[model samples]
Target: MKKYFLKLYQYNYWANKRVLSALTSQNVSDEKILSIMGHVVAAQYLWLHRIQGLPPAEVKLWGTYNLPQLVSMAEEIGTRWLQFVESTDNFDRELTYHNYTNDPYINNVENIMIHLVNHSSYHRAQIALLLRQNGFEPINTDFITYDRVITGQWKD
Candidate 1:
């Protein structure tokens, strides 16, 4: 489970960089980019806090990340996640915690990590869609594409 989540994290980082590079190329608005980047950062922070029994993070604007700021924040969060993973044991998958909304959650570690990856993927797609609607070409960000690129495995 830990290995799977680590693969997911790596995939997420790779996809984010590809999309962010495209976003930057288009000279996207500062506010929109910052908001998008910040949303991704906040999601990671929120889940990490939840996993560690820390207080919830304050909400931030979505779809509004400045290119440079978002990239920096992403890098920092990625590092933090890697560090956190270093201490994760197989038993972590069974740990449970309550979310900020008071919803009970099980499979604490894996679930939260999956949530972080999925959450970011959803929003990053949104940002890509926004870019496409504005006449820019969004990078291909499918999971299989990531897998193939990272692992050199091709699927028909």
Candidate 2:
């Protein structure tokens, strides 16, 4: 399970970089695009905090961030997630956390991690749609694409 989570997180981070790079390289200054990406990073941070038993009272779900800031924060949070996944011994540990609306719920680490990835992917698809509507082609972030790229170039 740990190895599976590590790979999924790796793909998450890789796809994020691809999305960010595509936006920046195309000089996309769309406020909505940046907002969605910012939310992605912020949500990752919030989830990490919750899983680690840290307070996330100040996290902004729709914070405004420029592409540069998003790039930096994305990398930072991605690295932190990788480290956390690497260090955690049990994925089944349950955590109780409150939602932005102050609603409480309990979920295990594995489930939360899965939610994090799916949540980011959901937002990424939204960004991609926005990109297409704005006259730009969306980057292919499919898992198969990532797998092919990595296996094609990576030697173990």
Candidate 3:
């Protein structure tokens, strides 16, 4: 399970970079894309902090960040997640944290990790759709695509 989570994190990181690169190359100023990416980064950070038993209020849930800032945050969070997956021994361990509305809840570390990845993928798809609507060809960020690249089956 640890190895599986590690691979998911790695794929998350790779897909984020691909999207960021595509956005940067376009040099387009799209508020929707930026906002969605910012939310993705912010949510990831919030989950990481919550998993570490920190207050979720310390991170912004809907903060505005430009492309460069979002890219940096994504990279940093990716590293943090990698370290966390590698170091944690118990995925089933429950963590208690407050939601944005200050509502307290308990959740397992594994579920939170899965939600984080799925959340990012959901937002990334939105970004891709927005990019396509804006007449820009977005990068393919499918997990299978990343797997092929890593396994030397796809050249990008």
Candidate 4:
């Protein structure tokens, strides 16, 4: 289970980088796209803090960040997530954390990880649609796409 979760996180990190690269390469400055990406970043951080047993801090869930800043933070958070999961041995431990609205909830470590991956994928698809609507080509960030890239099956 841990190994599978690690692959999911890895695919997540890769997909995010591809999306960020597309945003930068295409000069995507759309406010909506940036805002959605910001939420993606913020949610990761928020959840990271929670699973680390730290209290949630007030953070903007949907906001815009400059491309460079967003890229830096995304990479930093991705690395931290990988480290956190790798270092931890307990996946079934239940954690209690509050949402930004002060609502409380409980979830296990593994479920949280799964949620993060699904959450990111859901938003990435949104970003892809928005990019297409804006006359830009969306980079493929599917998990199979990442696997093929990893396994040397991806063609330029």
TM-score of each predicted structure versus truth? 0.78, 0.94, 0.95, 0.95
What value does the lDDT take at residue 150 in candidate 4? 92
The best-first sequence of candidates by lDDT reads 2, 4, 3, 1
Q: What lDDT would each prediction earn against the true structure? A: 0.73, 0.90, 0.87, 0.88
| Colliding pairs, model 3 | none
List runs of model 4 lying over 4 Å from the truth.
Answer: 55-58
User: For residues 1-156, what per-residue lDDT tens digits would candidate 1 score against the true structure?
Assistant: 768877787778777777777777787764664577688876787777667767775545344556787777677777777777766766255657765567986765766678779988888888777777878888887888988876768541
Candidate 4 residues 1-156, lDDT tens each? Answer: 778877888898899999999999999998999889888988998999888877673457876688887899899989988898788777888888788888989888888889999999999999999999999999899999999999999962
Q: Return whichever of 1 and 4 wins on TM-score.
A: 4
Model 1 clashing residue pairs (backbone):
33-65, 34-64, 34-65, 34-66, 35-63, 35-64, 35-65, 36-63, 36-64, 36-65
lDDT of 1 at 8: 81
Clashing pairs in 2: none
Model 2 C-alpha lDDT per residue in residues 1-156, reported as the tens digit of each score: 999999999999999999999998999989999999999999999999888888783658898899999899899999999999999878898888897778999988899999999999999999999999999988988887888888896321
Angstrom error of the Cα, residue 67, model 1: value is 1.7
Instruction: Give me the runs in candidate 3 sitting further than 4 Å from their true place.
Output: none
lDDT for model 4: 0.88
How many backbone clashes are present in model 4?
A: 0
